[model samples]
Target: MGYTIDPTIIRDRFARSTNEQLIDIAENEIRSLTPEALEFLLDELRKRNIETSQIAELEKKVTRQHNKNVSRAHSALAQDLSKEGMKLAVKMKLENASNSDIQEALQNTGISSEESLRIIGSLGEKAAAMNKTGNKNLRYGVIMLLLGCLRFFIIQSKDDLNETIILLLVLSGILFSIIGLKIKSDAKKISEILEQESLEAQ
Candidate 1:
């Protein structure tokens, strides 16, 4: 879905975020940023006059935190749905069944109303989580692209003993961009699988 967010709003939000919050975003939640939002983050860092070396260090500290969170969420979701339950749910979703119909179908299988409701709620939650993860991956991909470009410039400006560090940064950035795109694609697929009309609204 195409959308737009004001750059000033993004900048203001970043401006209000504390240094620790910014670092946390950089290290743990980079994937959650939009490309424009990530640019604003970089602008905020520049406004603070944070050194390139420090930025590089922050990049090095980045980990698979988002992956870990997604893994745990998926594990919980799996435990909530048996093979038969999952199949039934997917079938209903594919059939464009109403929330009430799906609920009734689930309850017909000896599941309680409460359990059926919980299952539906879990599906919504998982879809939302996957969507959020996809957004983050896109943001992280932008970050990688920006950092790779920056390193390429640095490599041209001066001869330094840190060639190995520069090479690693560039290579890792490329690798991350590729991986982020793949993760974003998977997240989109997961969202599609879990998408449904709101039961509450019905």
Candidate 2:
């Protein structure tokens, strides 16, 4: 009845993250003795100005990335196990199952719904605690992408008399910008969380 830290678990955390979050994790958790690292980490997070919701998005992304990595590693391990004549049950029961699987198992086993809710709620609260700053970059990035698309469309339409194509391009750009901002916003939030944790630890 003992526990172990799976390197794959750590790798899964990385795989589920944006480059920024991965960097933050490295700065905060994996690295030590980097001069004034905690203070610098917090300052960097402050400069980024991420928000709680965005941070939640980051956590989701990291979780997702972590899951993907887990899946890949699990699959690889399964193949190795197969070569060694290990049973499927053994493979499936590994610690690297997806978070969804973990949650589903907890729910299916009649773990109280309230308890599950509390766990989920706590995760959100953790993210909020990590990043107090709201995400300005997310707002600005979206606006800029939209404007870029609009400008590109107007220029093209006037040059080629293709109003329909111009409109479509503008719409596409706006949509892409909105989506990109949302993704980046999540990454920003994740970075903030890592930074906050790093600062506190120091």
Candidate 3:
């Protein structure tokens, strides 16, 4: 069976390809894509290599391409790949981004690779997963969750427990829930901002 080429995969490989490999692609499979599709393909490479000062122009061209004649899937794939280059500078160098974080995050933020970027891309607090901030959140969340459970248990175990202690435990549980919700919200926003930056390498 024939397999569809994943445009981003082609762009990713081509971005890293040697001149000889590019020639091979040109002589073979590259012929299948439309000229506009070809432009979109090359744009992905340019996105990563273009200088900062020139990014805005390229971005305008990219956005325009979105509404062009290429296959919608191809257009989307090209856009996603080009987008990755947008966030490369800030995302890769983030204090918590991995050693592999730089490469993986690039691949990820670039959306060159699939799926896992959600966790590390956002909560990679000050780095990749389990970084100082993420770890702290993980530890703290776990402790708070546990403490909340303990407080509930204490109330259950003692019907006569002081009203003050009961009130304090009630406040602790609510506080834990609020903080947990905030962390979850923050992680999602971070991931989204990072992803958006990739769209223009901002």
TM-score of each: 0.34, 0.27, 0.27
Ranking by lDDT: 1, 3, 2
Q: In lDDT terms, which candidate is top?
A: 1
Instruction: Single out the weakest 10-residue window by summed lDDT for candidate 1.
Output: 60-69
**What tens digits encode model 2's per-residue C-alpha lDDT throughout 4-42?**
245455435434556577456534452231223323333
Q: Who is ahead in TM-score, 1 or 2?
A: 1
Tell me the alpha-carbon RMSD of every candidate.
22.6, 23.4, 18.5
Model 1, span 1-202: residue lDDT tens: 1113787877887799887777777766666655556656666766665667886666443334334546666777655664456457645755556667878988788666887777766655554564566567667656766765777676575556455556665676667667666655654554564443433445
Clashing pairs in 1: 31-136, 32-136
lDDT of 3 by residue, 117-150 (tens): 4433443342232233444555565665566567
At residue 95, candidate 1 shows an lDDT of: 58
* Candidate 1 runs further than 4 Å off: 1-120, 157-161, 195-202
